[model samples]
Target: MSDALSEAIPVLLVAAPILAATLPLVFGLRFDRAGWLFTTLTTSSLFVATVVLATVVYSEGTVIHQLGGYPRAYGIELVADRLSTTIALLVTGTSAGVLAYTRLGGPRGNTFYSGYLLLVGGLLGLTFTGDVFNMFVFLEITGLATYALIASGDGPESAVAGLKYLIVGTVGASLYLLGVGLLFMATGTLNMIELAEAIPQAQGGYENTLVRAAFAFVFVGFAIKVAQWPVHAWQPDAYQHAPDGVTPLVAALVSTVSAYALARVMYTVFTVDFLTQTPYAREIVITVGAVSVVAGSTLAVIQRDVKRMLAYSSVSQFGLVVAAYGLVTETALVGAVIHLVGHGIMKAGLFIAAGVIALGYGARTVDEYAGLAARRPVVAGGMAVLLIALIGIPPSVGFVGKWYIALGAVQAEVWSVAAVIFLSTMLTLAYSARLLEKMYFTPANWLEDPHAPDADVVATDGGSGPGLTRQSDRARPDAVSIGMLSIVVVAAVLAVALGFSGDLFYDWLEPFVSEVFN
Candidate 1:
């Protein structure tokens, strides 16, 4: 492809969704449900665009598009490097795939899909933008759309969850903005590439209180956004209460992208040299990640609600990614990227399977899944595959990522972090095994009478006690659609298929990692 065309791809990718987002509301005037069709077409085209962008990136190298033909220092830059392109592909592809589920299982409306496309646009912008301030702007856009989507769920609890996410998400974004402000104060620039060059030359260099304080604020901000332990209070509520269709999208991409942003800021803007020279910077990052791993896994083991359990699982999974970031080795960085993509795929599939089970069998809690394998074999089988992948079983994408992470830790001789990774695997197995046993070994008790009025009502509370019941509403369908089932199966197949492609992942990522580390 020509350079000009390649550069234009990122701009079009970001603009298409944001501009298309308005069409849903406009078209809503005449058609009752034009949103899904528009969304499907838009997301499908975006995915194809990402594939072309990814092709250009991997074959030719990083593509930088300067907005309005201005220099990087003044103009907003959209970057489609190996890293960003990979993430952009995930954002687009997953957005399209989840539509398969939302088409039939819905919180459907034009407004819901407008938020959906807006969220996609925000995520793509986040992935491609090279300016810190623009990143923050995209962050807020993503957060707003997420809040609206979460609140669109069936009950008042969804609204409450959305409100909680809004408050917490706002604070997280504010902290990130404050960090950006500090960096701008220190370096007088907001472009990531410029900041990287300037931060080392700033007053007092790495030891500048401004620089260190900026890292602190930024790390903490993304920590909350990624749902790290102690600052993760808002996540379980958000995930458990979000519409089933919405949960898959948010759970898979939102925090994953946030974690990617955190990594970008760490290695690109701040650079590994800063972490190496600054006292306690690497130590603090590693510590937080390690602790979150343990805390999140322990929390997951105790949750009776399946969605909440999976929510905490994300905390643990992302902890691994964060810890790998602190390791600072090329191997570890590859592991982090691989895990980010793998986790997104696995989590999206798992949540979709959860929604399918809920729709077909009315099982939400761990105990409620008894003999699910016998009743809804396809979904149960898919969930089992995803859960096993989550546990890092060999030849699954999960294992590929964890293997690299573990190898990286061993090479770094951070035996402590290595130990945490092993322990996390065991803890993951604990929770996954619990659900697996319930699905396969336990007798089927979840078969409810079709005539019973309360048959579809499941407890919304994450097993804290008797809580608000989720009523069967127009948003939820009585049966799972083929599209939903197909998505689950496809995710399972990809989880295992991608496992064999670890070498390819490593090679594709090597150029980017080398650029950062060397």
Candidate 2:
């Protein structure tokens, strides 16, 4: 491809959403109808673009885009290596599924749809952008869209949660900006590649103090954005209280992209060599990751609200990915990158299932999920697949990530952390199995004794959270909507498809991870 063409790739993917967003907001002033038309067009196009871009990166290696056609060192650049494109593809593709599902089974309003499109676009922009400062701009856009989406929920709690998210989100953005400023002072360049090249040289120079301060600020700021351990106070409520349709998008994309940025900063800008040079830097990354894995999972186990449980679960998953990348080994970074993709798929599916349930019966608690399979079999089954995948069970994509991550931990002999990982896996299985048993094996006592004397199973949407409920004496919900079923099908298929594609992923990731030290 020509240089001009290559330079346009990042903007191209990002532009699809921005251009579509403005047209809908302006043209559909009164009607939300424009949201659907625009969302469909934007997400659909972005998906295709991601596929093409992924193929290009896999074939030709990293694809770099410089804004305004400036020299590599002088201009802001977007580099869609296998890493960025993989995450970008996940964000775009998952958003497409969410929008499609809501469009069909959700509240049929243009306002909601437009916000969804804007959110997806913002996330895509954040994921693909090359400049650190530009990332902050896109990050704000994403945060704003998220707050609006969450606030659109019918309940007051949704608004409150959005407000909290907004506040914390602002702090994160401010800290990120502060870090960017520090980095600029340290290297006089905002381009990631250039910073990576320039940062190491500052170790003993006049820029050394600024470099360290910048690293500290950026690292912590990204940690907050990604919801790592200490800074993760806002996640559960923000996730659980968001509108059902909006939960999955935030969980899957927001957290995943933040994790991606963390990895990029640590491995690319800070570099493995930089960590070895910088005092106590790698320690901070690995330590926080370890703490997050344990803390997030521990918190998840106690969450009765399904959405919150999954939200906490993401915190743990993301932490492990971060920790693995910090290991800085050949296969470790690959494990981290691959997990970034896997978690997005699994979490997206899980939350979508939660949303389906909430819409069905205003239910959000784990205990309330009892008999879900008997009610909405398709949604329940889809949720099962995602949960199993989350537990790292065989024949699902989740296992693929865990396998590599554990392998990395073993190779590096981080046994305590590995054991914790193992324990968390079991915890995941325990919770996953809880849902399965609830859906498939609700206790005989709670269930009406069909044969008992004068046993009356009062008909209230068959008792397990909402949607597709069947009362004892009334008609059961025949099935979940095709929109939800479609989302289920996509995630379920990928859960299995990813397993068989290990060889392909391994080959794709091998070169990228291997060349990291270079």
Candidate 3:
């Protein structure tokens, strides 16, 4: 690609989705079924745009476009580097993939699709923006669309979850904004590259109080947005209560992008040199990540709700990425990027499977999943593969990412952190095995009690059962179509296929990594 083409790619990547976001609501005035077509077309176009940008980025170099032909020093810029483009590809692909499920498995409305496109636009903008204040604007856009989507579910609980997420998410964004203000106060620029160069030259340099406070607030804010450990209270409820079609998209992209933003700010804005020179910066990052890993998995093990368990699982998965950043090696950074993409794919597949199971068999818990394979073999098989991959089994995306991070830790000689990375596999398995056992080994009949009083067993879904009440009983199985099942299968296959492509990712990212760390 030429220089002109490269510059245009990032703009299209961000702008196309936002322009398309308005179409569904506009076209809804004339047609009731416009949303599906518009969403499919918009996301498909965004996916293609991402692919082109990725090609340009990998083959040529980072593509930087100054908005309105302005210079980088004082103008807004969009950057499609190796890392940002990789995330852009993931965001667009996941958004398009979820349309397969949403097409037939509903929450089908023009407004829902409008919010979907807005979320996509937000994620794309978040990925491409190279200005700190611009990133804050995109973050709010992402949060607002996410809150609306979460509340679109059938039950009242969805509203509560959406409100909680909105409140917490707003705080996170606000803190990030405050940090930006401090950085601007100290450095007098909001452009990421400019801020990075200005930081070390600012009045007091690395030891400056304003810079240190800025880093603290920004890191804490992103920690909340990423839903790490103690601050993760909003995620489980949001995931559990979200509409099935909405869950897969939100589960797959939202936190993953937030984590990516955090990494972007840490590396691109603050620069690795700051972490190396600053007191306690690396230690605090590593400690926060390590604790989130242990706490997230432990909490996941105790969760009875499948969606809630998967939500907690994201906490642990992202913890690995955060910990990788603290290692501060090229390899560790590569691992962090790979894991972010891998976790997005795996978790999206898991949530889609969960949604399918809920729709097909009314199973929403480990116990409810007994004999799932017998009832829906394809969905069950896909879920099992995803669960195994999530445990970091060999020849899977999860394994590839975790392997790189652990190797990076060993190279850096962080013995304790490496131990935590290795032990994370066992912690993940504790909960995965529980679900696997229920799905493959236990009898479904155990769910029924012959001695139970008649009042306890109530009719669910028009006399189909006198059984235990299920949260998933709200969804009708007949609405689930083949497209939904295919998305899950495709995600599973990609998870395994990408495992063998670690060398490819490393090669593509080599230039960017060298630029950042060398």
Q: Quick one: best lDDT, which candidate?
A: 1
Give me the displacement of residue 511 in model 1, in angstroms.
Answer: 0.4
Q: TM-score for model 2?
A: 0.90
The lDDT for every candidate, in the order shown, is 0.91, 0.77, 0.89
Q: Which 10 consecutive positions of candidate 2 have the poorest summed lDDT? A: 467-476
Model 1, 1-518: lDDT tens digits are: 89899999999999999999999899999998899999999999999999999989878988999999999888899999999988998999999999999998898889999999999999999999999999999999999999999999877889999999999999999999999999999999999999999999999999889999999999999998998888999999999999999999999999999999999999999998998898888888889899999999999999998999999999999999999999988999999999999999999999999988777666788987887798678899999999999999978999999999999999889999999999999999999999999999998653442212245433332343323234222223455888999999999999999999999999999889999997
Compared with the true structure, the alpha-carbon lDDT of candidate 2 equals 0.77
Residue 306 miss distance in model 2 (angstroms): 1.1
Positional deviation of 414 in candidate 2, in angstroms? 2.0
Residue 346 local lDDT, model 2: 82
In angstroms, the error of model 1 at 354 is: 0.5
Error of 3 at 343 (Å): 0.2
Q: Model 3: which ten-residue window has the lowest total lDDT?
A: 449-458
